[model samples]
Target chain A: MIKSVAIQGVKGSFHHIVSQQFFDENVNLIECLTFDRVVEALITKECDAAIMALENSIAGSIIPNYALIDNYNLHVVGEHYLDIQHNLMALPGQTIIDIKEVYSHPMALLQCKEFFKNHPHIKLVEDKDTAEVADRIHKNKLKGVGAIASVLAANIFNLDVLAHSIQTIKHNETRFAIVKRTNSEVAKEAINKASVKFEANHKRGSLAAILNVMSDCKLSLTKIQSLPIIDTPWKYAFFVDVTFETYADFDKAKSLIKIMAEGFKVLGEYKNAKL
Target chain B: MIKSVAIQGVKGSFHHIVSQQFFDENVNLIECLTFDRVVEALITKECDAAIMALENSIAGSIIPNYALIDNYNLHVVGEHYLDIQHNLMALPGQTIIDIKEVYSHPMALLQCKEFFKNHPHIKLVEDKDTAEVADRIHKNKLKGVGAIASVLAANIFNLDVLAHSIQTIKHNETRFAIVKRTNSEVAKEAINKASVKFEANHKRGSLAAILNVMSDCKLSLTKIQSLPIIDTPWKYAFFVDVTFETYADFDKAKSLIKIMAEGFKVLGEYKNAKL
Candidate 1:
């Protein structure tokens, strides 16, 4: 049973929300500033598990986090999809007119760029984290500062929301993975999705052959990303996420892929959280 | 005859370097702070063409830039690969001991993270661009500030290089694409590569079938990236780069893919720079 979880930001972050939704509300929170630190805490047994964002619908894959998880040999035990809504917030008495400068994560600021054009007086500064900025504004009582973060951050940090859903795209979602140091303990019958990494041979239709095996085994490819192997200049390792109706289908496909592809490794076997 | 080229940063950025190496050194440079503005400058005829970094050897693809190019209907005429070297630069006569803060682009700061770990006293701040930070430090005569940028930036800003190749990875490379409002004017026989976007059908073997088509046509797949179609939640538009021995093979593959796939569009056709 997991009692403590590590996340890549302070309280009121998207990772914090994932921890609450995936685990019990009373679970202990271990805050980490960077994804590297999150993995470190898990590996060092400072936390039972770690939640990391894998991809965003708008921005695509967080490739570095994928590298961190693959390099650290972390397991994706579960997954959660969070709807990202950026809100501009400040101290209770402050309004958009009163705010002089806004500080938040660079990605958040980019997403909310259209909203800021109307308020040309507000200067945007990039910070490390979104919720951290909101927390700072509340604790420091910074008068003319605002933060772009989730609504939960405003509630948690006691800041008033000056604007809601200020992101340019209203349908932004991020996929987060619950990772552990060990392989998932999910029962076979309950497992419907799997993440795997493999390198195809340098020949024509090599990747297609592997995909054919998955299709023949009745597995649906949900996501596929290719990352260049660091030591090898031109070689690539393909990271794939597939869902199936039965665990036996995935099991058979995995057996065939291990034989067909080089450097075959199972990153995770988990329930399909998207469904 | 590309005269003026727009880039995402000042004259010393990787994109700027690409512009000089790919085009004539006498070409005019129109620097923009954002990729959106880079496209804007090209679309509005402020520059004859623009240079954009497509991917890095260390980091994966710059996904958002792909969106920008596709959305704006920009054409990629050529590509170049630059060996990236991040240097620590400060005002002349200043040593590393005197530097209290280091400013650079977030990506540059992240890449050179291992080097900064040894110097715990130096605070790392995220800025808009690496060359811009170097220019600021020099113009302001900031004594205790350092910027992690290219050696060319240090030279252009009249700053001293405190350290060379400070990035953790020594073999860093970035691929930049020269984009313009019109397609490549290179003769058909000279074109060896093409980038296309297509959406596979919602079936088990649809993607494999498309890859089979490319294989049968003798087109070797160089790169493949999938970005979600924002309106359609789970569906993805695959951005693929393929190199072939002859233009006839790519032409054959293009005709077949147009019939087999949905929303098939050619993004670029040019010589493969990696070769």
Candidate 2:
């Protein structure tokens, strides 16, 4: 299928990279400047689907993205994990010695802090987007300014890599979710994973009871996040992701959770991406 | 004893208002520009203690603050829920019609969207700080500019409130946690609540088993947040907030949870703030 995938940030961004790596090369790309806009594009049916970076292995969960999914009633159709490589890039002629200031998202800068520590002369400035900085450096011919982004960004913007994999941790990765508007969820024969959300009172054992159902059904609990319910004070809505070996096991778990939990909603049911 | 409290943002910010309402008025206020700085002040003993907004009723959990408390090994001594009222204020004489731009934090702007919908002429702009915008408007004597901040801000900045409690939700509240360096958690005889974090395997139903232990101990689970363990990609550390009627019940639950959960650590044990 020729899918039109919406992603936050411009071309050569991590979302863009994920689109290329996860989907067919012939797919049309719709670039969004904000995660909210990406959600808007999907909800309004402006794009077939959207890719959202849920959490960086190093930086932690993008909480707002979770809220966006829940608020917009989006369905998580699939998931992908991409290894993050933050490369220091600038104009073709620029080198480590030539650059005076470095610009990237605060998180990208934070990941590459140890590298920057060795070179104290280069001032670090936090910007909104990593690829945006790379694009700016390329377009504005901004010399003495470096951007920390992906190698793909360097290739796309026609910039030279002053340093490769400059992030402090080499094993940094980000989990991206392929989400479609809730109305567009198509059922498939082979499904082994599900994401569900529920709200409950602060009973002594209610949450534990819900999890026990998942256990009995042989579902592997991968992730659970608690989001405070906006209107209800001191109450929370829990988002849980579970994986199972068989479709029967997942269906049993889903039905059990739905019966046991309040305001239960299944976000998505698809094949486990990690496999 | 005289107390020194650290709060994020300038004077008259929401955090400052929380500090005043939550603590003794004699506290020496240490104003911090960022939550990181507030955490630093608590960790380094620059202040006797600190107040950090953990979550909002509308916008949801301040997940990063949970990371800060866990990473810094800080102790949560108390908590306070502040009813947030976002006010639109400008130069004393200028009315709503005269104002051109309304600036506040993105969340504040969002909360007041219904009010802004009525006043289509006012352009909503995202700013770094709410009180800071009020401070700027006052400092510069800017007539056409307005800020969405607290009543305290309007008073501190010498501005007139054009609209009061303009948030879409009338009962908006933010939960703030009182944290101190680990040294301050002296034995309290009447402890009723505790915040603990535990790391565990992703085995099917393993987390449920741990929760069962808590249920058996009669501890009421108020909140549970799963934060990504940065160094270990898929593994998560769950931060659970539980309240109990008796310290004995909590101690029993804590001990059992320790045996079942990996890397278990008590973040704090304190008197239940809600009670």
Candidate 3:
């Protein structure tokens, strides 16, 4: 039923790429420049759902996005792990020597900075979006400037890739969350992963006791992030991800965690993406 | 001999404010526009130390800074907590009604978004630095534009305060870490807080058991963040912060954690900033 999905970039950004591969290829894209807007589109009923980058292999968790999900009362219905491949591209017939400056997102530049070190002549310029830079290069016929982006971006902008997979780390991957207003309609049997939020008591060994509860339920803890409760100084709300092979085991853990921890809320129940 | 310190912005950044308060006010600053350069300045001995924002009460951990500290082998020698106060400033005699747009760093703008919502006529624009925007408005004598920055910025840029503490959260605070090339020079008895990094074996309840060990030793866990090991997919390097009333208790817990965990490394042992 997802006819249109909100993405935080243009046609060929990583969010767009994930949307294309995970959902129907022909699904409409509601392009937004910021993650806030992507959430806005979902709340305003402009899109059926949204795809958000949750974390990166090298950079770690996108903590604010987790905050937004909790604040907006959105549900993470599923997830996808995308192997990030950044390529240097420019207008057709341009060589690496001809490039005077390279434009890309700050993170992309950080990932591929070692490659640029070899070519000292090329200046690195931080840009907002990689695909937007490539599109501008092709649209304005700008010469001597290159952009580090995905291969899909090169194709969408009709540019030529000067280098393939130029990122410094070859195994870089990013996790994306598919979010919607309501919980996913998938069958209960398909659910193996669940993300929950809770607060540990002020007493000593509170978090340890909660972790022991998860362990006793035979739940595998995948991710855990602590978010500050702004109203209460020095207190935190823990966001956790756990996977299990059986629904009964997960249900038992959920019930026990709710009793052991304060402010417990199950954010999502979805099938394991890697599986 | 902390004579020189590196900061990520010009005169009135949050980093600069914390630096001035933590170190000597006259400490020469090696200003770097990016954290990467800040790390570089430390590695090259361009500065004696650096003040980096580790986490904000509302925004949670600055994950990449954690990665940079781990990867570059920098040691956190000290810590400070700053109460963030966002002030709206403009040219002299400009009233709130006279302003048409407010500019600040994206996080600052987001923090103060609720304050601007009542006045829809005034647009909110995202800029690189809060103090830099205030300086620009004062330098160019630009009217009808306001910038959300610190009181120090208003004094430095000669701007009038239109409003004080415009951030939505009244009790917002950010924690900064004073870092250097080698470990801190403080006396061992003065240290109560410590940050350690470790990876658990591929066994069930491994992390839970580690947390239990710390609890048994009377150490209070303040924060824990997971960083992905690039070579091993799904494996994480946990960065943990703990505080203890007695050094003997901490040593007991540290020794046990080293035996129970893999790739264990103590990043720093310093006095608790909040205390």
* Winning model by DockQ: 1
Residues A1-275, candidate 3, lDDT per residue (tens digit)?
89999998888799999998889998999999889999999999999999999998877788779988988999999999999999999999999999999998877988998999999999998778878898899899999999998899999999999999988889888999999999989888999998999986434588889989988988887787776676675576888888888889989998898887889998889989974
**Candidate 1 per-residue lDDT over residues B1-275, each given as its tens digit:** 87898998997888888887888899999999988899999999999999999988777888888888898988988889999999999999999999999999898999999999999999999888999999899888999999999888988999999999999989877888889899999999889988889997446777888989999998877777777676675577888888888999888998998999999999999988875
lDDT of 2 by residue, B123-188 (tens): 988777899999999989998999999999999999999999999779877888889885335465
Model 1 DockQ (Cα-based): 0.60
lDDT of the candidates, in the order given: 0.89, 0.84, 0.88
lDDT for residue B80 in candidate 1, whole number 0-100: 92
Q: What's the lDDT for candidate 3? A: 0.88
User: Residue pairs in steric clash, candidate 3?
Assistant: none
Q: Is the docking of candidate 2 incorrect, acceptable, medium or high quality?
A: medium
Model 2: per-residue Cα lDDT over A3-108, one tens digit each:
7999998888999999998789878899898888999888888898899998765556677788788778888888888999999999998789999999987778
Question: Candidate 2, residue B236: CA error in Å?
Answer: 2.7
Tens digit of lDDT per residue, candidate 3, span B1-275? 88899998878888889888998888998878889989999999999999888988776788889888888989999999999999999999999999999988877987898999888889988677888998899889999999999999999999999899998889878888999999989998999999999996434578899999999998887887776677775677888888888889999998998888888888889999874
Deviation of model 2 at B171, angstroms = 5.1
- Scoring the B chain of model 2 against the true B chain gives a TM-score of 0.93
Each candidate structure's TM-score, on Cα atoms with residue i matched to residue i, is 0.97, 0.89, 0.89
